[model samples]
Target: MKKSILLMTITTITLTGFISGCSRDYTPTAEATGEDIFKGACMECHDAIEGKENIFYELTADNKNIEFFSKKISGGSLLMPKFPNITADKLKAVSQYALDHSADK
Candidate 1:
């Protein structure tokens, strides 16, 4: 009886350890850069929008103003598409870059 109990206890511990060791350690991928995301997604519509005469002229004039443009880029208004899929941090970085590097008037 004593030997049987001891064997059962050892078997339980060994099985537990083996099962735990077999489990995978999951690690998430690093977040994508704002420029990368923009080049992949937003550039499509933006190129056309920026090509329009009056709108392009207006945006070019105020492009460097982050406060005015960041919300528009992240949330979308009028004809712009909302980047809802982007993480907040990435959206902010992309918005900042766009505002900072906007076409010079």
Candidate 2:
């Protein structure tokens, strides 16, 4: 009886250790910023404009608001690529970044 009790206690401790080890701590991450999205997606094309000849400079200036920026980004123009899969929040971020950058130019 004593031997059986000892075995059961050891088993229980082993199982408890295994269970605790298996459990993972997951920390939530912060959301990506506008500049991050822009560099990931827009920088491929927009990073450089020959002779600083950016056609969208004026356009972004005109449509600096989030609503207009989101619409333009989602719908796309003749030159701009359509980003249909981009989330609305991400679009807003990139739009805000674009406007801010344009302000510097």
Candidate 3:
């Protein structure tokens, strides 16, 4: 009886956690700001300004600009995943914002 009760408790807790995780609102709104887009699209793989992997990429004026950022965000690289659904306006906003906050900027 105790074993059955324990199993039931574990199952309930696991299902609850899974359901809660799937209910998150990950999609950004139409009026979302640059910061919002960055958080939704980039934050999963990168920390605020740095990559989460072995190679740390600190943004700078030379390497991080509107064009570079926009291309990287839309098309992605070997390690990055492309964000095809992101609108042009959203991409521009995030790219400009990233350039403005680069280390040398």
Candidate 4:
């Protein structure tokens, strides 16, 4: 009886650990591509003059550049409307794309 109880306790602990490890608190964002998000949200005002060049011309990855642009989009700027409904991950992707394509290299 003791051996059975010990085995059951060990099994319960192992199963609990496995179950907890498998659970994730964050929901995975849909795989929205950079170009897709940019075209959908940003292209209305800023023209995609040369593929990703337009976004690159105005933004960068350094100096909190991505955060700056994300805030602008979320809060609304002089000429740009507030994209309040946009998800954080999508904004991040767009900012990353601009930074990656920027000519500041």
Backbone clash count, each prediction separately? 0, 0, 0, 0
Q: Once all C-alphas are superposed, what RMSD does model 1 give against the true structure?
A: 19.5
**lDDT, candidate 2, 1-105, per-residue tens:** 999999999998876664443212211124778777666656555654455643334453456567777776677664555566556677777788777656333
Candidate 4 residue 46 Cα shift, in angstroms, is 1.4
lDDT of 1 by residue, 1-105 (tens): 999999999998876664443212221125666566555556554553356532222355554576566577556664555555655676666666566445565
Which pairs clash inside model 3? none
RMSD in angstroms, all models? 19.5, 19.3, 9.4, 17.8
Instruction: List where candidate 1 sits over 4 angstroms from the true fold.
Output: 1-29, 48-63
TM-score of every candidate: 0.50, 0.53, 0.59, 0.53
Show model 3 residue runs off by greater than 4 Å: 1-27, 49-57
lDDT of 4 at 68: 67
The candidate scoring highest on lDDT is: 3
Give the Cα lDDT of each candidate: 0.55, 0.60, 0.66, 0.59
**Model 3 TM-score?**
0.59
For candidate 4, the TM-score is 0.53
What's the C-alpha lDDT at position 47 in model 4?
A: 56
Query: Which stretch of 10 consecutive residues in model 2 shows the poorest summed lDDT?
Result: 20-29
